[model samples]
Target: MILLIDSGNSRLKVGWLTATEDAATQTTANGQTAGPLMRREPAAVAFDNLNPHALGDWLGTLPQTPRLALGVNVAGPERAQGIHDALARHGCPVRWITSREQLLYLKNRYTEPTQLGADRLVALLGVRSRLPSAHPPYVLASFGTATTIDTVGPDDSFIGGLILPGPVLMRSSLARGTAHLPLANGQVTEFPTDTHQAIASGIAAAQAGAVLRQWLAACRYYGQAATLFVAGGSWPEVEQEMQRLLKQTGGSPNTHPTAYYLDRPVLDGLALIAAQPDPLSF
Candidate 1:
């Protein structure tokens, strides 16, 4: 068993991968079984509040102790230390993943590639690994504490992206920065009459606008439609608005870029990286 962790800004996601042999891939010449065979397992996952105590307890609940642990941390070095210590207690040290100039066919186009977040890089790799046959122009939107909308170009390169305040932050900042807004808890309506609805509607619009702009820009740059993958906590609040926006927008030569919501893509990506025989090689 292998353990994979993604320590994000707000939470920590853990996945347990139990590798098994594939019956189809195990056969060799002369109807003899191969020396070794392994197939990918659908990982079982769990989460914690990013606290050392909570995370440690969760690790203790795993079905069996993992032999190796691999993870990516963007929650700061302190949290990284906590994760390291917890895994170390279980006798399975973690190998932290970082950004790279390149990873096999995927190239980092960031001016300073190392500055890119490991979560984003790993998430992109996860998407690419899932869509092995598809080529170019993919948009990934993560709406957590902060919203990140990134694009993968035709050449399989990270073409940079936009980072903006998430819906929660936008509303909280409004309430925090000013005195009048009472931390809007209103639902989004077509025409908001009250302040609460107005704040909620505006925040929804902002998130949708950011996602749409990036998706459309990628479409125009690549001269084709781009598939959009959205993940994170605030997705439920923004999905409807984005779907409305896409309907209002034209597709023309290409069909509408399908928007699919993914749960914990960062974890998915990390699991894929950890499964690699030489993950650090990338």
Candidate 2:
């Protein structure tokens, strides 16, 4: 098994890709579209209080020890070290992916190219690999703790990106910042029937509006249509709202005919990168 991990701001996403017949199907089931869909699901996943021992113990129970472990972590090296130590306990070698100058198509534009978060790098890598069109740019929107909007030009250049608070953050911030808006818990109800719905609507609009604006701007500046892929914890919950926002904002011409959400896109993207035959060896 090849282990893939994504350590985001609030949660640790662990995935394993086993060498088995069911791998493809399982990948599809994990909110991933296998084959041409450009993503996959981790064999298994867990979320904890970010405890290394708990994570390690969980991985230890898997059917087999992973031979290669690849992941992108936002928690920085200290937390990554803990994971490395734990994986070592199970005899699984770990390799934290790096953004070298020429490893992949992403030409980093960050002030410190290497300083970019692994999750963003992996997501960009996957986007470039899957959509290599020379005319239309690719826009990647990650809607997790904070919604991030990054773009890769038609020439496969990694320009910078924009970031804003995510849905949860938007709701929580509204509740905290305003007196009338109560804390919006995680419950889905029909649109604004009262103050709560109005609050939810406002929060949802803020979150979705950011995506729509960025997506449309990319389309306009790039001079070609763009593919918009949305993935994050809140995406499933607010997909329809996002779709409605997209339609209302009139950015579909720039947005892809279909938007996709992959089960473990960052992990799957890393796996795809790892699968490439080492050019150095060849």
lDDT of 1 by residue, 1-282 (tens): 777788888778887665762222222212344322233334556654557667777768867888878788888999899888888888887888888998656789899999998888888876665554447578989988899999998678889999899988999999999978889978887789999999998898899999999998998999987877788878878877787787677745344445666665676667666677876554
After superposing candidate 1 on the true structure, give the runs of residues whose Cα lies further than 4 Å from its correct spot: 20-41, 48-50, 251-255, 280-282
Specify the poorest-scoring 10-residue window by lDDT in model 1: 21-30
Instruction: Give the number of the best model, judged by TM-score.
Output: 1
TM-score of candidate 2 relative to the true fold: 0.79
Candidates in order: C-alpha RMSD to true structure: 7.9, 4.4
- TM-score of predicted model 1? 0.87
For candidate 2, write residues 156-256 as lDDT tens digits: 77777888888888888888998787886543444667776776776676766777777777778887666777777777656766766665555456533
Local error of candidate 2 at 199, Å? 2.2
Give each model's whole-structure lDDT: 0.76, 0.68
Clashing pairs in 2: 31-263
The lowest-lDDT stretch of 10 consecutive residues in candidate 2 is 21-30
lDDT of 1 at 223: 96
